[model samples]
Every structure is written in structure tokens, then in C-alpha cells.
Target: MENSINVSSEVGTLKRLLIHSPDSGLGKVVPSKAQDWLFEDIVHLDTMRRHEYDYYVKTLLYFLDTEKIKGKLNEIDGDESRNFYKPDHPDYFNSEKVIELQKLLADILEDNLTKMKLIAAICAIEHEWYTTHDELLSLSPNELAKTLISGTTPGNEMLFPPIPNFIFTRDIGITINNHLLLNKPAKLARTREALLSQYIFYNHPMFAEIRKNLIEIPDNETLFLLPEEEAESNQSTLEGGDVMMVAKNHLLIGISERTSIYAAKQVIKVLFEKKVLDKITLIKIPKKRDYMHIDTVFTQVKRNMWVILGTLAKPHSESEDEVLIRSGLLKSKKSEKVHLVQFRRGQENEPRVIESLEELLTEISVYDLNCSPLEVQFIYSGNNEFPFGAREQWTDSCNLLAIKEGVVIGYDRNDKTLEAFKEAGFEAVKVADLLQDFEAGRRSPETIQNTFILLPSAELSRARGGSHCMSMPIFRENFE
Candidate 1:
């Protein structure tokens, strides 16, 4: 049951897609301290999950013979009741709940440590669960360094950190011409999602099947980005939330709140090693408190085209600490690394740098592409002051869901963003009222490309990731 989206085509039908239906995992959040819990607002987890299921999962399930939870591990690895170990995991055996969870997994999996890695896998799933009052109080210097990466202990006064808002299979990993460059999240809060994605991609039968293409390639043929490059992070530094898959061969990397220019560079290097993308176009999303991903700006509209929220149409300006480029690398948005790269290794590759959203679109031939076969478009975001207009742009209005070909679903908050679609002669459907932005994160394309997991849990709503940001489509309908 492997799924794929055909690239190099004009506009492919979304023949099959992956979706994560929300679940009880969200009930873990404490609403009163929503923001502290990585949530912008509050919603009933049970009802919210149900709502997303209807909007994303059930709506498209019949359209696809979606792959359910991978039963391969259940039969072999036993994630629920299996007991695994990670001697170097740093946090294993730290919490009572984790210990209990381990036992539960062991009972369910019934495998020896050598055979099972369930404990580590579950810890990887529970990103915030590792941060506890006890764990925080007793941080050694090493753990302290890791905690500092997360900035500071949140003021939520809760037992566990919030799970990832969503790990839509589509967002975290995808087929880079067959081999999947599964992203290892730069942010610890979202690390669990990466772990889950890793599990789904590697342990699951379908993704595992496709992996052969990756390993079978020639050794010097190209390795994609090395995993070591992805290891660099500032802790609370960034998440996959900000990344955007634009052209079939390019990645639109946004250096904003959660994602840094340096981190993006590192990620790109990994992709290059794997031959994932031909190049990565770095886009500077406004570093506001609200908008976390580039997805808050745009997504696929029709075949060979995109529907972008207008705010990102502007260009980049020098930040306070910015410095002049020195040839090898240029000034980064926030981190110490250079934003424009001459020879950086990872996420930073080819910098088709631009200052404004309009410039970026022009460089990508977005206007011309839209007119021809692609039909790419752009619309303004927010009322008057978009990120380009306003000092702050977060509601994630830019993230959109491409329904049928050029047809799309998106947030209503920034109605202006829809102008691009209209201008391009594409139909845009407003889903604000009926399709709530269940998670504070508004990025669409969250669902898995061709599965039926439903939004992993209440976390998607809590983390503010929309369907787009949550998913990473391995396969898509070819639209040549």
C-alpha cells in the first residue's frame, strides 16, 4: 500500500493522500495555559479530533483505499506493549510514567531489549513527556544544555510538554524521487513527531518497501543529506512546521520563529546528499510569535501551480544583528550561521535569495507559470498590516488544502490571501466556519498522502499545525 505523488507533471490529481485524524492524545493538554502548552487557543480534544476526522480522514477515505496503522509492528515490534532501551537516550528511565509506559510496551511487545526498541520509540513520540518537574529539577549539565536549547522550562506547570501539533505523514517525510528524506525535527517539542514519522516510514510495511530504492542506489550516486547535519539545533530552535515544498525540485525554506536559516541550510545539505531537491529557495517568513511555518503563507492550488497567501509576497530586509556577506556565507535571519551560503553543508544550499514575497514569486516564474499550465496565484493576508503589512502575522492563514486540482480549502481570517487564486482564475473555497482550524497551526497538506491514521492526536490542534504542515505526501496524482 505504498502511495506516491508524481512530480514533473503540470497538475496531478490527488489520486491518494495520507491523513492523520485527531485523537485522544490531545486531551492531554491543559486549556487554561494554552499558549504555554504550545497552543494558541483551546478546543475539546474528543470533539476536535472527531471534527478533523470528518473534514480530512472520512471525507477522503472512500476516495482512497487508505493504509491504516501499520500492523507489521503490531505483529512484530509491538509498539504499545513492547519494551526497548536506549542507553544513550539521555532521558530514558527518568519518569515514572515513562517507566510505566515501558512496562506496558513490554507486556504488549514481549520482546527482549536486543529485539525491541519500543521504549525509545515511545519516548520519541512523547516529545514533551520527557520534560517533567522532577526531570527539570534534576538536570545534569548535559541535560541542562539540552533544556537550554528549548530556551526555558515553560510556565505551563504541567506534567508533560505538549506533543507535536501534528505529524501529518505528508509534512515530515516524502519521496524525493522515490527515496524519502525523512526530516529529523530541529525542535525537541516536535521531535516525537519525527520519531513517529520514522517509525511509520521505516517500521511500517509500505514505506519500508519504498526504502529499498534509497539504499539500492549507487554508493557514490549520491547519499542525500547526511543525518549528522540534521543533528544541529538550538533546542527550542525550530520545527518542520516552517518548511514548504514548492517546485518539484526546489524547497521553499522559511527562516522564522521555529526554523532558522542555519537549520534550513543544514536540512538542505542532507537533502542534497540524498539528491532530494535540485535546490532550496530560502524564503524569510516573518519571525512573529504566531506564524510558525512557511506553510502559513502558501500551498498547492492547481496542477503545476500554487496558491500563496499574499503577505509573504514581500521581501527580506536586514535584521538588527545582520552583517554584510563575506562571500562564503551571508548573514542569517536569527542564528549565528550565514543565511546565504557559498559552501555550507546542510539545509542551506542554493540561495535564490529575495527581499520581498513579490520578488520571490517573480524569480520562481510563479506569475508566468500560473498563466501557462501551472496557474500559480497569490492573495493578501490579514486586514491591512499583513506580515508584510502588519508587524505580526500568525493565524497561519496562508496554509491551504488543495481539494480537486485547482480547487482549494483555506482559512477565512485572511480573506485577502485568496486574491491570488481569483487572479489566476482558480476557485478558492473558504473553510473557516465549517472547517475549523482545529489546531492553532493553520498549514494545510497535513494529512498523509495515502493513509488513514487521522491526525495523530490532539497535538495538531495544540501545536497549531494545520493539515498541510502535518503531512508529507509520498505519492500524488500526476497532472501533466
Candidate 2:
């Protein structure tokens, strides 16, 4: 059997994680195209590639596989080898298959040397990206990986913008309680992430046996299409950043600027049908770039403790609640306004409406969490102030990556938020300090507890993502 995923809690000990190295994609962005790709400012490709992302990759390699698959290009390069193997042979493929593979390589690859090297590397991974049966078996694995990371397309003369956000792999898809939810990205800039992630989960040999258990959302476009139709503005669109697993049987999905309420309903419907989720909590935040996804403003860092934005941590007033009710944003038993039509198999049932968002969540937790009551102590970003809190949040003060029950990582520039964590009993330790301790043989990561290991923020923070935004945990032990 292949390695399986089992993430049940945010703070569980992380065993396996998925990450993407920064590539030529970052260089593809120019000043005029920066904002369109969700970049706040243009970045120097050399600085981004050489400095900012190196430590992040080093940190992840400490916990996950870091080896590169070497290929056999020299032996397989000649036209004779390409034309030799047939379907009946163990190696799989014949002359026609080799021709198609050669054509594909020529269309996407710029030089003969790079094309041969990539083909060799792909041969090592033993997977194929094909248009047909013979074609699939003919191409090598290195070619597929190169195509995914380099943003090259077959038959397209014009180069597309490399997906720089691909470095932030956390936004693509999420594994919830052993089931992989292949998400549909809300932006064209991030569509490649979804496709590549699904390909890895479904076709990679590492997940070959466990692929049967994955539940990929079927509506997303997998292949790039030029002059594509505009996505229905009102239709459902989901992103992994908006989904959170709060408990073993409980999930919290944000219906915010990036994720639509329709998207939340679609995910909720699938969860209910699978019987894996007992209750689903939907949080509605302001629709804006600053609060694009829930993880940007909210994440659980430890048991009974969450990092949240100051404005959202506060409860609503009676008058404010009443206004929401009247506006049809908040429903009640007296006014059961229907907005979502629930579907089972191919049949549709009566519309599902909530009495009140807060009420629904509170009532559900009362049973699922038992007497502990699922009370989460929130540590808000900055103090209770206007622009100060907003400024800190914009820099990702609330985006924290939880390594284990008590260890977490975030940007060091968020001083105010770091102080808040210190006040809440989490000791603040700089990455330099932690690295020094390990180097001197005084301590290792396992020996640290209830500590916030701060990472340098000069370049990474400028990209508008913290540690949590960059990593996607694949296997976390159950905390309970």
C-alpha cells in the first residue's frame, strides 16, 4: 500500500508535508502584471529565488522527503531506444509512442539539452502525461514535473505568466481526516496549483494505492484553455485556504472574498453525504483582498487557543444582529429564507436555510465538543485599535503555522502579535536562536514546547504570506 494522509487537527504532530520550490515562474511576473497575479509589488527574481525561499525549504526538508529523483537520459536519448519498445514489452511503448512524446517535448521545451534532461528525469518517476494510451506510456516522468513547475505549454507560442503563488502550496487543496478534497481555485493565477496537486495525488506512484480514497471536486478545469469562458460570476468557487478542520468531525469553511457561499454549500453537501463530518461551521467575513481567505485572519495555533483578527474576534451587538436578520444575511425560524438547494445523488430536495449563523454553530458544538464546550481563546492581531490592527493583519500577523501541539511558526515582524502569544504562555524564540541551539547540540525541535519560532520576514512577508500560507500538511497524527 502507498503512504496515506491522515490530518485530523491543525496542531497534531506533522509527519508529511507538500511544498513547491520557487522557479522561473517568479521571473515571469513584470510590473504591469503583478497585481493581476495577486502580487502587491514586483519582486526581484534573483532575490526571491536565492534568498527568501531557501530557509523555508530547509525547514520543511527537516520533516519531509527532500531527495530529487535522478533519471536515465543518456541511455534513452537515441532514436533507436525511442523506437524500440512496444506495448507487449515490459518497458511499455513503441515507435509511434516515442514520436508523439518527441513532438510534445519539441512543442514545450525550448532547447534540445533541456528536453533530453527532463525526459530522462521523468523516466525515473515512471509516470506518463498522455493524450492517448500509447502516448501516456511513452513520455517520461521528468517531463511532467518540468512542465508543471516551468509553466510551459505545448503548441503555445506565447509564454503564460508563471504561477509565482505556486510556492504557497497551502492554497491548492486540503486533506481532511484522510480524505483529499481537490479544490477549485477562485483565481486564474492559481488554477495551475489545483491541476498539479490533483495530478500528484491521482497519478504519483507515492499515492498509487491510496488514490481510490480521494474525493476531488469534479467541476474544476484541469487543462489550460486559451480564450477561456469567463467563470459564472455567481457560481460556486472554492479554495483550500478557506477550509479548516476544527475537530475530528467538525469543519469550518469561510465564505469570504475568495470562497463563495455557493462553494461552501457544495463542500458541505459532499461532507454530509460521505458521513465524515457531523457539523459544518460557516464563517462570513468582509469581502476584500486583505481578508481574501480565512487562514489569513484565523487559525488555531494550539488546543483551546486560536490566532484571530481583532475585528472578527468580537461578537456582534443586538442591533447589528437584528440588521443582519432583516437584510436576509441572518435567518430565523420565523423567517426561514431559503438560498441553497441541497442535492443528493442527482435528486434535489427542499432548500436548506439556517436560523442564525452563530446559533447554528453554537448548538452544533454543544454536542460535538461535549462539556469542554469547544471554547477557543483567541489571541487577536495587534491591540484593539484601528489602523494598527489593520496594518498588522495585512502583514499576516494572524497567519501561524502549527508544527505540533504547542510549537508554531510565524513572521518576526509581527511584534505586537508575538507579544500577545508570549502573554498567552507561548515563549517567543527567533529562528536564529533555534538554529543556534540545534547547531550547538543544546536542543532539537522535539525538545521545544509551547514556543513560537519566529522566521525572518524581510522577503517572505513582502509576498503577503506567513509560514501557514506556504505549507500544506499531508499527514498529522490525531491529537486526541
Candidate 3:
């Protein structure tokens, strides 16, 4: 709904965040349709919801209220309305249209009949039963989402496969330093993701002071693909999950499935014009099932070290692959061209020039390129299968969250990938409670509303994805 290209630095600290709670949608992901709905298996909606929510509550409790982290946020003002940046808040998150109508309905017919009639109309899309004689569903989404233990159908549409994954928070968008880049979701079903994000940028009182609130920023006619509103074309397309902030100036974009190069070019054009970026290197990875987005394969944990799910940085097959190499530190620390070195794999572990992070940075002239071992490294799910390639399929290594300096969060499945972080001087912590694993197909969520990751399945089979695919971080804690 709102496209504001606000990204500049990678070390910028995260001040406020928007999150959506897993809602009634979790109840709809039936085991029968889990495959088409993108789930491995159905989960016990209630228990799964609890596991997922606690993960966020625990993390936030450690940050938002803590004096150390609170003081670090650049913004000092704490306005409840600013919490538009927080989607879990019902005032900004629930369908405003529905709420508005409900209020009007209540004013006219403030009886049980009115309440029941109103709820039935709102949930006509889904058949919901009225437990209270009062008619109106009294439980907040968080309450229903948290208390739910098991269900055949997901009550909330946004929380299921196509939508439930939004809770991961790492997939939707990211912050390169202090700048925030809003992710453009690819599906209409997830279009509400943009709506949800807009609310977070608008209503959340705590996040009211954020600089990139799309709703409040001066609307730029130049940024809109269809400024006329009536213009139509099959060409307008973009998804936040396909983009990643590789460095302060570098972004690894995937042109596949949801987003295309045309959209990538448009976004790049906007960022370039805004002086938001100095360089843009598009890495067109294979558009296979395993390669959904950049998050599926690679992520930068420390300053120099990176965790790659696929062999994009390595060799793929018997043929020799060539990659473009650039210098990020050359000319100057603020060199216009980002240094990107392509690793060529010749058959098997063939020796290549500039091997290792040390050589990679030195050759690029990043003399002071410094990043201590990260506190933790997470993958999409808990899949520990290494260079086995399935790591690219099952475990999404691309979904990474740099919450603070050297502190990151991600799926807990990449057991060995965690080793990759430690090898780079990080203390990798594995966490697996963020997603709803299903029994049919393997899909991960890159978006997280507030702290909820939406997925269709209440169970784990092979259909649904984990946190990396459900979230997109518009801001982050400093990395370097």
C-alpha cells in the first residue's frame, strides 16, 4: 500500500517494530488442503500459537522495557499512537472497516441481536460460532491466538500458509543501517500485509516517531508505479521477501516467483534517485523451488562472514561459473561501488583466488572491516542438513534478524549452520518455536506482524515455512 524507500546504514539501531499476532486464521488451515495452502502438516492451532507468541513476548520483554536497549533507541518519545508501528495492538490492526461498522451497528441496535448480527456479517467470510450470549467476540486476537490449542480451520486468514507466515518479522523487510526499506509482498492474499504494515507505520503509539512512516511521509508521485490510480498493466509487481540488505549499500535481490527484474529495477531506480544507495548488485539466483528469495540461500551474520544455503558463492555443477567481483572498500570507505566477489567452484572445492573472509575483505580494501562473533545465528526452520542442498529447500538460511550489535535471531533448525556463525566468531542460538510446521509441503514465512508468524497449517508435514519467510525488518540493531 505504501512504498517508502528508506535505507542508508546497516549499523543503525532498531527503535520500534510492528508485529501482528497469530489470529483466527490459524484455525482454517485444514489438514486436507495443507498442500495447496502451503503447509507440511496441520498443527494444534492453540499450542502452536502459544509457542510462537511466547518467543516474541520473551524477546520483547528483554528489549523494549530494558533500560539498556531502551536508551539505545534514537527516539526518546514513547507515544501509544506511534505504536502504529506495532501491529499486535488491536486498535490499529483489526480491520478498521469491520470495527467501524460494528460500532455503528451497536449504536443502533445495542442488543444481543445486534451483536450477533454484526459478528455474523463480519465473519460471513468464515463461519464463526458465537460463544457468548452478548454476540460480539469478546476475546482480543492475541487472546484467541494465544489460547487456541487445536483447531481444524484457521480463524484468521492472515495467519495461515499464505498469510500466517507474516509473523516471522525477518521476511517482510529489512534495515540497512538506519534506513528502513518496506517490502512489497507478491500476492493479493498478502496484500493485507502492506495494509498491516501501513497500520504499524501509522497507529502504533510507540513507533509514532519513526522517520519512515509511509502514511505520514510526503507522498511522492514519482514513487508510485500507478500514480494515476486507474492505470493498469501486468507489469506492476514487487515483494519484500525477495530483497535483502547485503551491506549498507549492497542489497541481494531475487528476481523470481513473486518479484521480477522489472520490479527490482523500479525499486533500484527509486532508491538511486533518493540517494538511498550508492550501488546495486542484483544476484539472479536459480528460480527453483529451493531458491524462492535471497533469504533462502544467504545472509550476512558478521561484517565479513556470511552463511550461504546454496552454492551461489560456490560451484554448482561440472561447468565453471563466473561471478562479478567488486570492491566495497576500494577508492574510499564510502566508495560508490560495493565490493562483491564471486566465488567460483570448479567441480569440487577447486582453489580460487581470494578465499576466506580475511582475503575477501583485504582484497576489497576493507582494512577495518570488523564484526565480532555474533551472539546467535538462526535459519528458516530447524533443518540441519548442510551443503546437502536441501538446506536451501527446508531450512531457509536467508531469513536472518540482526536485533542488535552482533545479536541476531532466526529459525533454530540449521544446527550446523549455527556452527557457521561460531566459525565467524558468533555464538549461534537455535530457536524452533516460531513457526507452525505442517505435514504436506515445505514453505517458510518471511514476515512477522509484531511477533506473530502466520502459517496455514497447525501441524508440520512439509507444506509450511518458518520465520525467515514471514518477516521483513524495516530496522535493525547496528551490525558493525
Q: Which predicted model would earn the best TM-score?
A: 2
The candidate that achieves the highest lDDT relative to the unseen native structure: 2
**Model 2, range 1-480, lDDT digits (tens) per residue?**
016577777777777766555555666677898888888876775555444454454444333322210122223323343322212224432222011122223333444445454444443333433333233234344443444455543333223456778767677777788777777777777765565566556544545555776776545353244234544534467777888776687677777668877677768778778877666666666667887888887777766567777656545566766876887755642232212122233232443444443333344335443424557456778854555667889888888888777788888788778878888888987765565565455766667788887777776666777788787777787754
Q: Which candidate, 1 or 2, has the higher TM-score?
A: 2
Cα error, candidate 1, residue 406 (Å) = 0.6
RMSD of 2: 11.2
The local distance difference test score of each candidate is 0.43, 0.61, 0.41
Clashing pairs in 2: 85-93, 122-141, 122-142
Q: What is the C-alpha RMSD of each candidate to the true structure, in Å?
A: 12.5, 11.2, 13.9
Q: How would you encode candidate 1's per-residue C-alpha lDDT over 75-182 as one tens digit per residue?
A: 322343322221113322222211112122223332334113533444344543544434544544333222222223334233335452542444455444455545
Ranked by lDDT, the better of candidates 1 and 3 is: 1
| Candidate 1: regions farther than 4 A off | 1-11, 62-115, 120-164, 167-171, 212-238, 303-306, 309-311, 316-352, 365-376, 382-393, 412-463
Better of 1 and 2 by lDDT: 2
TM-scores for every predicted model: 0.59, 0.71, 0.56
